[model samples]
Target chain A: MNYRIVTNNPSVKEVYKDIIFVNGTFLDVLINVRDLVHKGHELISHPLGSSIRTMYSPYRSIIVRNKTNEINKDHIEVIENSIYSYKNTMQRRKPDAVNSKDYAMLDLNLLKSALDEFKSIYDY
Target chain B: MKLELGRIYIKDIQFGNKTHVNNGTLIVNSQELIDKLKEDERVKDVKVDIARPGEKVRIIPVKDVIEPRVKIEGKGHGFAGVTSKTEQLGEGKVNVLYGAAVVTVGDIVGFQEGVIDMWGEGAKWTPFSKTCNLVVDITPIEGLQPHNHEAAVRIAGLKAAEYLGEAGRNVEPEEVLTYEIGTHTEEEAKYPDLPKVAYVEMLISQGLLHDGYIYGVNSQNILPTLLHPNEELDNAVISGNCVAACDKITTYQHQNNSVILDLYAQHGKTINFMGVILTPELTTLEGKFRTCDYTVKLCKMLGVDGVIISEEGYGNPDSDLLMICKRLEKENIKTVLITDECSGWDGMSQPLADTAKEAVAVVSTGNVSHVVTLPPADKVVGNAAAIATLAGGWEGSLEADGTIKCELNAVIGATSEIGYHNCTVNLY
Candidate 1:
């Protein structure tokens, strides 16, 4: 499926581009991003015009876990979206992470819709 | 001829020389000689003269009777006079008439005259010359013996219990749980901050819960999306999913247990069906639904006594109903499935009733218990009562009550009196 990254930030565009190219898709890139976010990683950025520059540090420090886990691909996508949403909400409220919500609400609707779509295609 | 008690007198005494006795003379009275020697030849021309108290009479030839050589027959025969006019001697001993030498206990002796008195004089009597032996014969009488199925069931149950514990837990049995998910309807109502809520009630009334645990899964809140970011949500989803999966597995295990019990109970086991039913609402997506054969086979495998299916509000028959009947018949399982529409009556459809009749007929012919059609939901109790009446007797009358009390009464009464030896109403 074709994926696109939409943001007004010129500096963050380079970071999103690098992730998309390296992971081949927004979903694949989000998996690494979510793990970093869960482990207390922070994104540093500066505003350019009306947008802010966002940087994604490489996940060189995150341990490589067992590769044979059977968690559904769709579940991974939801966790990724929740991570992004959490970071975005924190950035919108404050320039620095002085206070943060303990956990972000996962978008169940999006995940369910995606699942229903997948089921339709597979006819399962 | 008779002799004194101390004197030795021999008549018809065969020596090793094999000389036959001929004419002989006795020193006893003529009447005594005639009475002692019933054989005509023994006394035909023999003269018996009474001698002095213990004197012995000399055997002098009457005319030159060859000195009356003392030749005697080896065996002796005499007619013991009849007593009650009945042929007492020949009553059953028909083979005793053969002249076989047989020694018998008796007090009288023909050799002694005064030792044993003669009751009558000149009374003619015939004696059997050849020895006769008495023999008794016997013979035995044959018929049908019936077998006890209850005893068989008990023995099987005990043996099964030894090899297999109560629920066949030693080893995994086969899956007996067959279930059908009803067609999903539109959301009845939605909760304000919650994802659209749907009411999903399984249509499992068609199958039995005989020996298995049934788990209903409702993962309304633990959607996959909610599993992310929140540990609590994730935990809930994991727990619910585990329960759902485990319940399915356990149901299958118990289904197998029932089959083992049934094998012990009925001697045969088979799979009949395990599939879904097609309803009118599902017609648009007929191809989307699986067949009802699986459910039928599962029911048969588990030895389900009956199945109850809730009919859709519309008049269309549930496909599973017919499938259950046919498959149960094929596997020799007694089945009774009910539809919701027929709920007002005791789960009985003319078709279902007919099928039950046919199944019962087939099983009965093979010495197996017959199957009875359980009326649909509406007729369950009433039909049971009707069945009770037909069975007759006090037990049947009590069973007509259609209550737990009735079940107990019927069991106790039937088993005690008529020896009913199949599954009873109280067993379930």
Candidate 2:
């Protein structure tokens, strides 16, 4: 089963033209992937039926493959490190990329912090 | 001259859209009213308030009247814009242009109120009109004189010489005169076969040959020589304190302080003394006379028959240059000015050129011996040496390297041609 990812951000469109889903994992199938991620975007998911369960936990972490009930800190750190390295590379490639106003996918910590702040503002 | 007062009469007048009158009964002596009437082209004639009762009306030409007008143009702008997350939106933009017009007092132009209109996307509205007036009057002035050719040539020559002198070279008179009362024995001994006019012309031309009078050195250093010619003269038999006396003999047999005097004596000519040295090399200003005073002292010391100085690049030389010319005039020293590198401030060059021209005119009119200027270097078309040659009024190749390469043709071109016109191309 396969899914796709798309973003409306012009900066994202400029870099990541498309995304690909292979097996159970999603991969950014785009040229200049770093630039697309650095510009930012809203993350949305589409899943193949019965193959995976997608759940956004209270901690703002996106869960996939229900068989792994426990969250692995090392795996989360690897993803975070990869995102940070991609952003750094994008910055070096195009200094003006950061100045662009664009939506982008949020990592667990950033997503959690933003959701927390929103909840506090709403007194929820 | 007869006292002729100009007459004025209104040519035409128009009062709003009601009436266009060739002749009107609104009699008045006000120049302001006359100017306004003149502006109205519809008015063919205006009545002037004469002292006499019935014949108070007088007709005047509109062209003869003078008028003034003012026109202005201005613009202002206001703008706003917004965007929402629900949908994509394009930013808004705005721009405006406006101006004003003025009619001359007596111009007789059509009067109309100007209107401004504003209309655009996401913009506000405002409409308005501006009314302006024009004025006119009458003025009579004098005309100028016709151009003088010989005077122009003399001025050009004087300017050229002055430029060269300022650049630091010893220059000579543009013209020379000689009175020969020699014995027949001397003529027979020298060249009895030569024609009198020919010989005299040759001698005078050589003696009068005045070109390249630039002070190669600064004038201040040359001052000591001027003040003490006798002490500086060594084995120079014909050396004299007076420049004129030294001009009688040719050949300097000495190498003392009076090198300039000896050079003049040997050459039977005058040497231009620049009075003070001023160059990038001498960083200090202590030894230099004020530029103006130095010019005057140089003219006096060198027994300047004719003096030329540039008014370009230098500041107000009027008082100093004029005073020197006056002083020289009293002692019968001719003075003229050349201008280059005009100072845009005060229109100094044009005025100085005018004054130099006037000076030449006065001397020529008085039948006094005048100083002529040399043709200037064609800076655009020639090398440095060629330019210097032109500046010095000398015939030679003045190369960019500052070398004065003389040819036989150049030497023979002018028999009395002196080497002082030679340009030194300082390679360093």
What local lDDT score does residue B342 receive in model 1, on the 0 to 100 scale? Answer: 15
Q: What's candidate 1's DockQ score?
A: 0.00
Model 1, B2-23: lDDT tens digits are 1001111222222222222122
Off by over 4 Å in 1: A1-124, B1-260, B264-290, B293-318, B327-428
Candidate 1 lDDT score at position B416: 12
User: lDDT tens digits, residues A9-120, model 1?
Assistant: 2233443342222232222344553553344432111000000101111111111112333443433433453344324322212221111110000111112222232334
After TM-score superposition, what is the CA distance of residue B213 in candidate 1 from its true location, in Å?
Answer: 11
TM-score of each: 0.16, 0.17
lDDT of 2 by residue, B306-347 (tens): 544322111122223344445545656554432211111222
lDDT of 2 at B227: 19
DockQ of each: 0.00, 0.00
True contacts kept of each: 0.00, 0.00
